[model samples]
Target: MNLKRINIPSRLKGLCYTLVIIISFNMIAPIAFAETTFEVSAKAAIAIDADTGKIFYEKNANTPLPIASMTKLLTLYLILEAEKNGQISWDEQIEISDHLLKISEDLNLSNVKLVKGSSYSVRDLFNASAIISANAAVTALAERVAGTEKDFIDLMRAKVISWGIEDAYLISTSGINNEDAQGRIYPGSKENEENLMSAKDMALVAQHLLQDFPEFLETTKLPSTVFAAGTDEETVLESSNFMLPGFYYYKEGVDGLKTGTTDLAGASFAGTINKNGLRLITIVMNANDSNGDGGLRFVETTRLMDFVYENWTYETLYPKGSTLPGFNKIDVPNGVDLSVPIITNDPLQLWHRQDMNKEHLTLTMVNSYEALDKNNQLKAPVERGQQVGELQVGYPEDTLGYVDGSKQKTSVPMVTNGATKKANFFVLSSRSIKNFFSTIF
Candidate 1:
């Protein structure tokens, strides 16, 4: 009665506006984002899966510098390949060549004591090079493979280029060039020259190695294995890398590779680790700045390993026998009803980013069709696990990887079990037996 009838709407409007003020405050409050910072200062390094070559974490991964003895991983890989291909037998005896002897004696950091003219098995040379950064052993193997250490070095350069390792150089196999010795030596002298690699390139090299030489783990993980000490058993070799300490994270399926040092390159390492069917390779290059040797390389490598084990994780993308959407249906020949179910090799999961969702990642298909080839013999849809298509995820650029992508496959014939039989005589009247496929579809 006190307010005029015409003013009632305006008064209510003001009250409504006032009521909304309380809700806006609740809506506009800031969210608390829990983020922790982990700084990466290594020149370049990366961690990745051995099978997929999926990068997990990286810093300066493409920056190629002197990788030190980490290059041995490549040398080792080629040598192993040669053995596998029958080009070189494990028992094939190789003598210490002049150049090899020179590298062995010159690299003061580590040596397998390649006695000139002394014969050793290819296996011995490979073992020495991998177990303890033996320049002599690596050079001996390199020279044997391509006829000279120089040629082997050329192969190394070409391979690095192929592997997308831009920042690395392989002037020496042992990675034993002395940084301090550079000032006094000539341009190409061992003292003046050096090997280079960033953390990322080193990791890639390790990745290639593990993929190429699955057997390398057997030798590198011996914790402490002796090699080629005949007549001088005094020189029992050990893993210069102390990662297998009385108690360490490396013990859990962490296997081999090479370790390196030199005043110029600092300490470098590359190796593989497999746990719970999840395999990954980690490389640390120039992680240690101290040439005098305080073992910071081990300390830092362990830290990187810790970050990987704790902060990062692996997840399957698509499990076998699973049906995917979009790809919910697949194309198969003589597939009953003209449509076959789509299946994947592994369960689809956030392999690279276990913390993210499958819906968010970009999924792409790898096109592989089974048609009549020049000679067709009723191939039963190419082996079951054959790659027909793949699902790849696009991830952020800051991290080293975007790996969860995997191969897709056409489902096995549903009617092979004899399910495609005509349900009724009435069905035969609609179309020819073969046309039934199109009609039902």
Candidate 2:
């Protein structure tokens, strides 16, 4: 039988080979890809786990740049620290310095119109600085704490250093742009200083602030409040942070943080959100005011928060009394029972990307044997609920090598489910004889 041979053009043959090669390359490649990344119109940004200090997402996080009014957070930190150390009292009256008043008047900077000869309580000043980003109130608070704005700035630098944050520099207590429209240093200050901080360092500062003075949230969360109520100089100061209530970008869990803006720094924000026992700190710096609406910082912050909340979720890896798979029991040597059921005493929760399914999850036990030889088996006298090991849950990559930037392992304490006592001498001897006979047979 004669077989007919089909003829094809050289270009068509080359195209067929190219298609086959491309198809083979795609088929051999791994199906899993990296998580989707959202676009942020900011110079730098970061999102961190407030509890663990784990970084979830970052862009130019370590590059120090002007943080604008966000510097008030550090100043607030100093004030709160002083209050905690008995160095300052909330109700103690603070006299506005002539220097601060002059700066407020000459520069026409953002202020609560603090009266020059007015003596406002520390609480009132704090409210103005925190809620409205009042420049004069913060400067006055700094001067009260450290005797001079320059000295207070020194303290701010020292505080950031003590927190192991090296990239931050404080020139003004209020984080106002110290340069003029022509980029020249504004006169009347001892030196030309601008507050520069990286997104990561800002997150660290915010974490410290939240942990140290969680009570500050009571003031920052307010959209508007009276600065000095029941007084002649009473003025209604409103929060510049649009993420709070009464603004369009407000979210239920968003509370107590700060916003910043200047020609140099544009718009920036150091925001925090607490939801379902998970608190996250997000910082976005130098976001553009694309629409000139004057809320780009808040808009970017809201976007970052939404992305994080949508892509990540908290799940209980192991619940109490749940026996670990592949490790249902542990051998209890010289005990009343041959083995005891190994179970977790407490639940283990892990924050991870939502795409990771439960079926792909893995758990590994890191056992601690007190008195065991080569086999590392448990000894008798094992009490119920006694911690014997730790169970770690994550993906295989996280469980094995624990790659950085990947999901972190959540470790749960494992314990014995039942009590076990030492076996009697007679029983031990009988078991030894039986083991020897069985080996011989």
If scored against the real structure, what TM-score would every candidate get? 0.67, 0.78
Candidate 2 off by > 4 Å: 1-33, 49-56, 178-193, 274-278, 291-293, 332-339, 368-377, 396-409, 423-441
lDDT tens readout by residue for model 2, 1-441: 111111211111011110001112344554452455576778999887776666666888879998888889899999998999999999999887776666556454677876777899999988989998888888888888888777888888888888887777667788876652123232344344577888888988898888788898888889998978999988888888888878888888899699888777877889999876678899999888767666777877878887877776666655668876666777776787888887877766665665544554556666654434356667887888876666656653222122122344466666788888989999888888999999999
Deviation of model 2 at 277, angstroms:
5.3
Stretches off by above 4 angstroms in model 1 are 1-36, 164-167, 178-191, 229-234, 245-250, 289-294, 316-346, 352-399, 402-441
Can you give the lDDT of residue 179 in candidate 1?
A: 48
For each candidate, C-alpha RMSD in Å?
16.2, 14.4
**Tens digits of per-residue lDDT for model 1, 144-181:** 88887667777888887887656565666556564432
What lDDT does model 1 reach? Answer: 0.57
CA lDDT scores, all candidates in order: 0.57, 0.74
